[model samples]
Target: IDLETYIYWSGDIGRQFAEALAERARAAVKVHVLIDWIGSRKVDSRDLAMMREAGVEVEKYNPLVWFNLARLNHRDHRKLLIVDGEIGFIGGAGLADIWQGNADAPNHWRDTQFRLEGPAVGQMQAAFMDNWTKTTGRVLDNEDYFPELRPAGDHYAQVFFSSPRDGTETVRLMYLLAIAAAQKNIRLSASYFVPGALTTEELVDASKRGVNVEIIVPGAKTDVPIARYASRSKWGPLLKAGIKIYEYEPTMYHCKVMIVDDVWVTVGSANFDNRSFRLNDEANLNVYSAEFAAEQARAFEEDKTSAKLISYKEWKNRGLCTKLLERILAPFRSQL
Candidate 1:
């Protein structure tokens, strides 16, 4: 199990999650947990001690040390859970109070998690090992971790990951290529929707080419206020190009999913902002199947019902103080 944020709060939900893993460890399960040090800052030491005492190998990624100060901005944002090298799960969720209940209220966030099997599960395990190896200088490269995988379904799926360490714009290029190749429509649901100038241009071009470009983002329930400000400031061009943007009204929309032309679907931890595309370690599962894409489209349409469309006029008439805050955050857009 690997997560960005694993808050060990004093809530029943938190206790249940921590104890579940500890129980697994006590049952002689080789439970290895990796969490981002900064992201899991709210986690209690006693909870970690309890897990460690149960024989769970827990490690924090990129702890603040003197030698690691230079790369502090880059974080491991991937959420992965691989059980016994068989089933795997990946999405944009953390172990926190906000993720306790279903998205029936404002406090519970709206998110998505995919439980997958087959060869894709092997790729997901590889993605986990990519970080597990980096966090601990040992590799788990045996049959217990990498066993023979059979096809679970007829979907053509593959997992790809990107990092600043590679000095390549992999996730960004993937989004651009998908946008550039979009023919019928592009339904994008991002929690953080601060697309930089280049991506904005690509989206605008897609909109101009008659692609029904629709995006869903968090509205008033956003955790990153500055990211929302920066995102709104750049929506003028997209709105002008006839791209439809909707802000979720119920709660925090923490889903990072994209569907193109009802044929391709990519979902995982990568957001539509520069922070996810450039600075953070991200991973996405790409599926080239129309059947799976249709299912995701159904979910997107349902979420759209709970979203409020923001017109171009509304965006233009935002308060002067809000505009000033956006301008102040413009220079730091890449870091958002």
Candidate 2:
């Protein structure tokens, strides 16, 4: 309500934010919609058509079968919206279509997205443009996409982007770095958790060091039954190593969050699984700044408090056949 700039997302909490956003977009400057084709699953052919008709500039990253997208595996998993190019929103949250709620239902979802205001918003615009160029094959040098991207509010922030094509193992490295930086604690919440060896080792090592380590993966998932069981395969080793594990039974958790020592916080589209680290195009934001870290840390704790904590005893009680299936599926993390 103060500045001409605003950033909004539309999944769950983001839905309320999106309606307000639509009004602002139509009456004010300009609205740029950037979303992942895979993440926005409920967003179908009709939805895209309506968005385009609404005068809101819309673009889908790595469009699955669109003739424009020759490579189907590569998708724009980054969910960001830039209002007037000076403020932006980026995180695990996609526009509300399928993701609606949290922990209790495991069938719903648990996730969060942030609205950022600072010089960093410019970098988000740049990330959007990079994807836009790749998807549309159009040069975005014109002022229409990026007006005078200026700071509308005070906050220290940075925008980070990565993909199979971007040429940097940034998403994985950032997670490793945050884990390495943890001194007192590490908390991770994800809907999916088939972590890479590095991530797996870090979580194990952190717990061994007497650092409090906790992880949450969906007990119920929005995907395949085999994949859900596959995710549970590695939990035994992790729990045996002293890492506390929890499965949200009420709904499928899609939250991608990690808080390390209350000094570092990460939020975005990347999961701890190998598919995110090695296969899919992903995005994550690391905030070293104290304020954002605190907010993120608080959110992590709140979610943790409301979640179901898994016990080693219960995990060990599962049938031997179930355990075997997970390990067999574990090797395919890179392909998932």
As a whole number from 0 to 100, the lDDT of residue 260 in candidate 1 is 99
Q: Taking the tens digit of each residue's C-alpha lDDT, what string does model 2 give over 1-336? A: 111111123344444544454565567545556666555555445444544455556656565565746566666667666766656777776555345554445445677878887667767777777777776687666565556656554445577877778667788888887787778998888767776567788878887888899887766445556656766766776889988887765566778888878766778778777667766666566666677778877777676666688888988888888888877876665766
lDDT of 1 by residue, 1-336 (tens): 433332334455556767888999899878888888778787777778888999889898888899769788989888888887888888888777888766799999999888888888888888888878887999988888888999999999988888888787789999999999999999999999988889999999998889999999999998888889999999999999999999998999999999999999999989998888889888888999999999999999999999999999999999999999999989999898
TM-scores of the models, in the given order? 0.96, 0.82
Q: Name the lDDT value of residue 309 in candidate 2.
A: 87
Worst 10 residues of 2 by lDDT: 1-10
Best by TM-score: 1
Off by over 4 Å in 2: 1-44, 54-57, 63-70, 100-107, 142-155, 221-224
Taken over the whole model, the C-alpha lDDT of each candidate is: 0.87, 0.67
Q: How many Å off is the CA of 53 in candidate 1? A: 0.4
Please give the lDDT score for candidate 1. 0.87
